[model samples]
Target: MSASVTPGEPGIFERMFPIRERGSTVRTEVLGGVATFLTMSYILVVNPAILSQAGLPFGAVVVATALAAAVATAAMGLLSTYPFALASGLGINAVVAFDIILGRQVPWEVGMACVVIEGLIAVALVLAGLREAVVRAVPTSMKLAIGVGIGLFICFVGLRDGGIVVNNPATGVGLGDLTAGPPLIALAGIFVATAMTVRGIRGSILAGIATSTVLGLVFGVLDGPDAVADWPGSDQFSTIGDALDPDNLADALTWALVPVIFALFMTDFFDTIGTAVSLGRAGKLDDAQGELPEMRRVLLVDSGAAVLGGAAGASSVTTYVESGAGVSEGARTGLASLVTAGLFLLAIPFVPLITVIGQSVPYVGDTTVVPAIAPALVMVGFLMTRLVQAIDWGDVQDAVPAFLIIAGIPLTFSIAAGIGLGVLGHVVAMTAAGRARQVHPIMWVLVPMFLAFFAEDWLSVNVF
Candidate 1:
């Protein structure tokens, strides 16, 4: 049955979003949007918290995160007419922070410029009709492995951020003082979030972060915020437009960074395809060919969001898998995304509260601090790992590469390195198995590129 409308007259939302045609109501869409916002809102705190460690001001990142999410999510709704909401992706942001920015010793502006470059590439691929081709070129096992490996990597970071893991001179990494105030708060947060998730509670991750923040305050591990809300000004948005600077873009376009850009692009590309496909399936929105309606538009907006997010210094915004929450709440159209976008915009004034939630608290000593939002990271990492079972462990050719990715990412603390190793392992394993003919031509192309990427430092000095 079509959605009910006022007798003989459809409302504006009905005309704009075609709610009746999609078998949904404005009320339902609004509810689903709120559900999605709640489910993924943890990014408001977590994204800035992670980026701030890379020298971004927490307040500015907070503004950038909210504005980017609001704009991107709104565009998704209005342009694609889909319910998927966009935000700074967790794993991608981690790569920007730990690998691109810190590991490469580049300025944060340059790191963000990489996001813009990858996003523009993604846009070009979509427009040229090559996005789907690229997706098919990758082996299914490697794709699944990439997500699983990133999940483990994110979880490892969460553990460290929460003081659950500590550096040890003897063994590299060991357990931290769980009995300590900050660690205890984190433990309680993890437990609460886990239980809430198991109980099917909405916004459980955000709740977990809130719980930890409250505990930190009570235990004196965190200081209280001076205000609940503060109007943000132009000066507060210092991170905005940083990615668009010519110098940053030029720096990011160096010859040595080509592989890095490809790596980031691959992550952003595959992740959106996976999330959109899964959400479409769950919502029964896919057609006979299993393609969602307006899929091209969806991809365009999601890809462009990476550019917007990076320019705003919020990393690469992509379609959130948590949008499945909205889908589950019976959202079938972009109206839901519009609602989610509005909520994100409404959240901007509460930056002070978000800052407090993301604030770091002293841990082992004055030199050590633990994030209040670490539990959200831990929970999100667990959610991302659900794709692991999709890998065919029985096949040695696939398993070898999958294992390399799963183990290498966290162990090496480098997403790019892990992906490179996995791709190399896949090529070698397939050749060894006498099935080289079956490997995609693209995989072969990537092998030499990855080898060069791995040897970039040596080549820079010896050859370049």
Candidate 2:
């Protein structure tokens, strides 16, 4: 039934992952993988909720998100032999929803096509060995600012989605009724999750989502699922392969959209590098220079993940900082990633449960559908803001761009625009401070491109 091996020879798993060489065993890797999955599993509900707003089917997105995550994460493990997991990224999903689809008035398919295009471009960059050049081109302050800005943007969106924030005709934004069911539940969830996070609990965000869902059910604000379980079929994958459709691809490939694609690429680019480096250091997997071994392989997998995610109708998938949870639990090899990937696939049958947790509760009017996942979003934003300390705030040249990014994101409701503003701010601040030589030449090229991006509509009407 099986091929015989020499008595002292390493088994298949051992040879493939070299678990013992990494100072770990199979049991440790599995446990670490479980810990990692539990911490980030909130994305199952949250990603669907965010993408559904852009007209993606909630159930279909749930399936796509899980499958895409499984495939991407598994590829990362097999190819790079690193204990990192990939999933539909938070800020990028927001871009797909609010910016490309809603703000630009494009169809969901077109937005996703843009994601695919960005991914392909990233793959080309990695293959051409230009990824590092691009990475070094952006100032570290600006890089940190992008994450911080996105955190604020996500937090703002969470507040609005949870009914904790509402639009005001006079002031443009105002607080919502905390006494209402949705906002009340959101507040309770925030308290619980924040407390758990402070206590060093694993899966704190998932816990918060569960608590909010329970509260929503108790208050009759959310409806129970009609079915407890169901088999996943082809029809449930409504959005799959839409990104590769000819018409959608054509629509996404246009000169007017170059800046948008660049924005997506930049976000995806920096996020992977920063996350990989941090995870590597946390796991003690980095070399003397604080760089990950086989980093090019890792980047390749991550870049390919974006293409896979978009083709599957998920947003751009990338390395998760939550992989640190696994690292803390002694996950130092690809085995842990394999375990996480398996868990994601195993979760496919539980689509109904995911939908129940992500289901919208119409709160104030037909326009507002409050989600239970808001607390997690708020917590994620809080985590990202921690990066603010790493920025050189004392230097005005550094502070200006970072400040603009932090303020621009939530204010403009567009991550791409916030990044654009930050880049422009960086150039202006450096030039004004007589430090213009420090500006990367690539940044100069981006200045006019972003300017054109901001004025695309006007240019289309008057010049283009």
Candidate 3:
């Protein structure tokens, strides 16, 4: 009877996911999900560590992180049928906690309320198709360049976070001592993973991270877990955003808050776009228009995740580029994301294992080092770099912007700025070459918006 059933029905997992067409199975997808989750699970602890600085309770943020990420990612799989997982975004969290809450003296409650507001706006834009329109208006070069820029930025983050890249007062950045234990292990993982990748092996990125982690444990670089689990108390749960009052919401409606909201929106918008483009290209999953299939739905889910995360007392959430880890592992369907989401929920009971293994940072004098996760990021960055060849490098108008995006992303340490600069370069270069008439009107509109972003930055530094 089961074999007699038709394939057109949606009830069957194989029918819905089309595992045969994707050359994937439940087993492969499950393994891929585990790999992807392992690569980015550091977010579980990192998000709390960052947000707690804003007076949010650490344990509560952990629960919130898992809750928000699990819900968003599960929705991604079931709604958009994408393998991507969503989580509290890195840059957006910094904007929320560091810039908005700490620097602007806005309480964490107000900042989260703004995040909810931003997400609502995003929902409107996506549902109205304006978000897709703006994305399509961007020049092809700019889109491809944004992908490359994010790839470079990921590598930069890996280097810095791994303690392989250090600061210098004389110039800007200097190399870390390769002789040190933490950095040396990172370098070793890099070499090992690069070799495995070159050999066309699967799961090289996750494998490298595991090998490095084992080494860290053996060398006493990574300490054991402090506890088996630390369940968040009532004070930790639902504490943030609980203080959001009518007065604070009204106060946040002032002109001063516009720039902050705009900045938050821009960063979230571009980071999600860049990550999507790069991941799509890597998987050969996007349409010829450089848009993912059912992308609007994906954005809707992403925006909704942000709102839910903020309301749940976590930071802004979005789709993760670390999904590439799963994609590379042959996860061609939503089942992979479902598996990853399940892991996130399951890991809640093993908080100690998570913190000790994936999120550990040992203090070496004044600096704290995370030796395991950084190498995985570096490996993933290396893998994502193959998207660069898709750019039209022969045209100087194209190449210049591409180069700016690729370089500026890492140098300026801002993904949104990198995308903006790339667009700016493309428009100016095209106009200078008397191709102004051929340029898209959207570029003209966007150029000014990007300028406004910079201008706002200037005014903040000089005027404010």
Candidate 4:
């Protein structure tokens, strides 16, 4: 079918092909498509890098993970009827790759097993009706904090992925050397792309990536036999089993595997829920009960993706809030995901092209770029930007909770922890001022849970 025909209402094709619907005719679609493409282009190169770091073959992780994300995301749109796209989650990848794989030193197979287990847990939670209850248990302010925090976190991740930020021993953390090599070239490309995006250039993100990649090659940032391999060819179907040996499997299961399984499930569940709630607000997909239905579908798709990601030899799968960037560009249905999937599938033939691009990009140099902290920083900035609407600057009691909520996220590196602390601070402030009656009973329940969560983490660290 062609575009939907109702006036002011987008057509089916428009709904299906979200990027194309931003404006009325082909021109609008092209603009939206470019924007959509730019926003997502990073995944094409970044996902493979992250997954390969976790010990999967680059070829297998890229092709299989992309295909798995496509299938699960399409199912989300087709079944739940939401306009969300799914991909290997942002934070969860680090957790899987670093904590599970490197820290625990688990085999990729065991990491995949953990993903599958986590996915099953998520599915079970949704079926048990815990999804809504858990979300409701969180306060509105806290939820908003999480949303903004994660957004900033994602942006930070993008900067890192683009090689704009690197660690420094002398300054603790500072800008990379931009003038020395590919990092400089990459930074230049990002700036150009960002400028183009600001100037309303469609596909600025894609352009930035492409420009940086080309510059990387020209500057000798990436060169080797691996760099020149053909795109799709027979290499694309390589699997996890290729790198995994039978001898390592037994040892990996005994030590590394168990911890990874636990970490992946717990981290993905919390991260998925947080991102879902956050992005749902951005998309404005509130349920009849005033909650975001997208949150529920997020749980489902994320969980399913985790399971499939395991089979496909990737880490824990979760929803991509980056999709919200696409939504902001006017994607309102699964069609956006289908398009994303289609793009991934098509890229198979150009695998070498993407590899080259990844190698060519440069890292960001200098502290001016901002610390590689979580998205909480951006969320705080966003909240402060609208502080007048959400809170009164004159009231210390009301403002303290918000302050703690914002500061606590990055300070602790846990959004839920920050929220929990904020709630406790709110409760204490109200009680001390003789306003204890104003506190909701439901809020009381969270205090204990928060305490337990922290206590567990503490005990694990101390004892284990």
Candidate 5:
């Protein structure tokens, strides 16, 4: 028998998928779900693309990764009771595919193993109560800066992915030639998506994606039945064994497994923690005491998802704060996420659906499409709010740390390093101004360690 809800005493499912409260109607929930899903749908394509580049069978990789994400995300909604969703992280994928796999030529199986180990570390940290302590240790300004910095970084990623930003050695970053093909159609779709979203239209992102996809089809920018006919299927479970091959065990153990494990641990550790705190503040998910509760649950689920993702043949898993955009639109409980998860679960059978859609879209040409537009516009929105929220606009002391953190992420291509440097900078500035007592004592230990680590990296590069 199906579960039932008691009158006025919402059952677990009811509580999870609560009906609309003030300022949020049934329509709002539906719209929020679409936004959340579209924003995350990139994983369906990107994950397969990356894993395929790493020499995994495209079909098996896509199916397994999607299934893992579905399970992990459903667990987050059911277990954590937060609206947050999980997927293969953006920057970490670049690090995995580029820095670890391709750069070091580590076997893909070993790469998966590293992801598994990192997940274990994350789980242990959350269980040990260190997640909260570590988050609290970060300065408020630093936290806010991290949020904005990540947003900017994500925007940059979207731009690059959509082909809005093309490299030109002669003139640095410039627009790609619109005549170049799929990128043009993708660009067009971005503007349309942006226009719909700006007017507060429901499913603006979805509309934009659909519109671009259709244009691509009409213009021959995308493939038709041939792409589907050639598409891979999920028949290669043995690849998982190859990924864990004993023959490649030693190289995997030393380079691929070890470095990636450390990289994922440190990177996702800070990324998830910072995102939770920031999104908690944004969604007002704090408890009666205004502290974030159930945080361990969020971290545990995120970390657990990584392990599951690795085993299932994907990269690292982390929470997407873009889901907060849905929350800002009024998603109070986990139901929104459950609904989002349901859609992803359905999309698995439609892998050809994604490839077809990707192919059918028309290039945006000179006009930017909606999806591309939304993030840039959202970045503007965040910047304006941040400027108004600044505690002391005139003080260089406050401005310096914020600037360093914001600029450091893309500059170093490491969010953790950016935050670490920002924290150390803040502590130093405070201490030099005779405000050392105002700083937390833990700062003394952490700042020195951060400096020492970076110093070691520099020494290794320069001297060795």
Candidate 6:
């Protein structure tokens, strides 16, 4: 519990941050920020590794990821006067790297353009107060299903990345060589993270990655960068900026990508909102209407951060639920986030140290596999699965759409498609149950969009 300090008696740094008024000390806020950073530092390694698969430069991605997150998080604190930290989100990165850039074969630049579009759209929605409407318009079932579907999708990515699973021409996907060194390493990392979690270790995920990297070195599967640590020497930072060229967006945009943009927006939209709402509620920051204070500034910062992240050649940035860790440790204001931002800036000296695991190995049938980061992806999936138990399984109407989303994501390997199919499923199931009138009108509007989104490619392939 935080003790109250006199209102007008400002100490050094107190007038600006008002840490004392918020019931926190500089020391307490500093400790809280450190705690939050430890919890999320795994992203410094995992994100670039994943995004690199989409043909991005891993080292530059390291700098972009840290710098983007630091700036956004610091803005979140200064703008909202809240302790929330922001970062490039996990699932959205998978969708960008796997679904759009690789699976859909869209250029990474164009994929980034879509992220910029998502940010612009978000800014419009926030300014117009339409975000809340959209959130309500999405049926509860579809909302829950989105999380579950994405969880499965991320898990599948991890499995394939580490080559623990393989494409089976006879069926769909199959188990890979359990005897393979890469898969074994991934499996061991997963077990290590799981064990540390069970043991209540702080920074368990980061520890797991470190342990796996060391084990990989021991088994002669992991190789260090030609130069272990050195001054910056690449154009990776320009990767995202190069994507913003209008020609790049034009080249990337096709009928198939309309839904991809919407999907990217949707994931970032809900993730930020959910993180803010849940963390705010826990922190006692909600009003009688259940809205957080200074929400407008928060939304602006969130949307702007997404745009900045896109330009930085990273994933969509959003408020981190990990901020809760800091809040729990006595972070009552933005000082904690400021502290975290500084730490991120301080990590710049070790960017090469973080890139060691971004490299993948080619093996059985010449498959390229990113073994090191696979464990982190799988662990993220596990964290996402917590929301599934909140869904109402007894109601078939809800169950149908939820199941479609959960099953369709990994099966189709497309986040946009899974969401579209889930919407269709929900609408159709409700109509069959004589509850069509209960469906949101926005959903009806989406029916045509979803149909067109699905049909565009087929129509293009088969018709004029």
- Judge candidate 3 against the unseen true structure and give its global Cα lDDT, from 0 to 1: 0.74
Residue-by-residue lDDT tens digits, candidate 2, 6-70? 78687677789968888987789899999899988888889999999888998999999999999
Task: Report model 1's TM-score to 2 decimal places.
Answer: 0.97
Taken over the whole model, the C-alpha lDDT of each candidate is 0.89, 0.89, 0.74, 0.57, 0.63, 0.84
- Candidate 4 lDDT score relative to the true structure: 0.57
Candidate 2 — which residues are off by over 4 angstroms? 1-9
- Give me the runs in candidate 1 sitting further than 4 Å from their true place: 1-6
Clashing pairs in 1: none
Off by over 4 Å in 3: 1-62, 80-85, 88-118, 235-296, 310-316, 319-339, 358-365, 457-464
lDDT of 1 at 239: 96
Regarding TM-score, does 1 or 6 come out ahead? 1
List where candidate 4 sits over 4 angstroms from the true fold: 1-38, 103-105, 147-167, 224-299, 319-337, 360-464
Predicted structure 2, TM vs. truth: 0.97
What is the C-alpha lDDT profile of model 4 across 149-262, one tens digit per residue?
A: 444444444455444556667865556555655546556666766577569765555566666555656666654335444556555666534323444434444432443444
Q: How accurate is candidate 6 locally (lDDT)?
A: 0.84
What is candidate 3's lDDT per residue for 77-96, written digit by digit as tens? 88887789999987677667
lDDT minimum window of 10 residues, candidate 3 = 356-365
Better candidate by lDDT, 1 or 6 = 1
lDDT assessment of candidate 5: 0.63
Please give the distance, in angstroms, between residue 396's alpha carbon in candidate 6 and its true position after superposition: 1.4
Which is better, 3 or 5, measured by lDDT?
Answer: 3
In candidate 3, how many Å is residue 395 off? 1.2
- Model 5 segments beyond 4 Å from truth? 1-39, 46-61, 81-84, 98-114, 225-232, 235-286, 291-293, 322-339, 356-395, 412-424, 427-431, 434-464
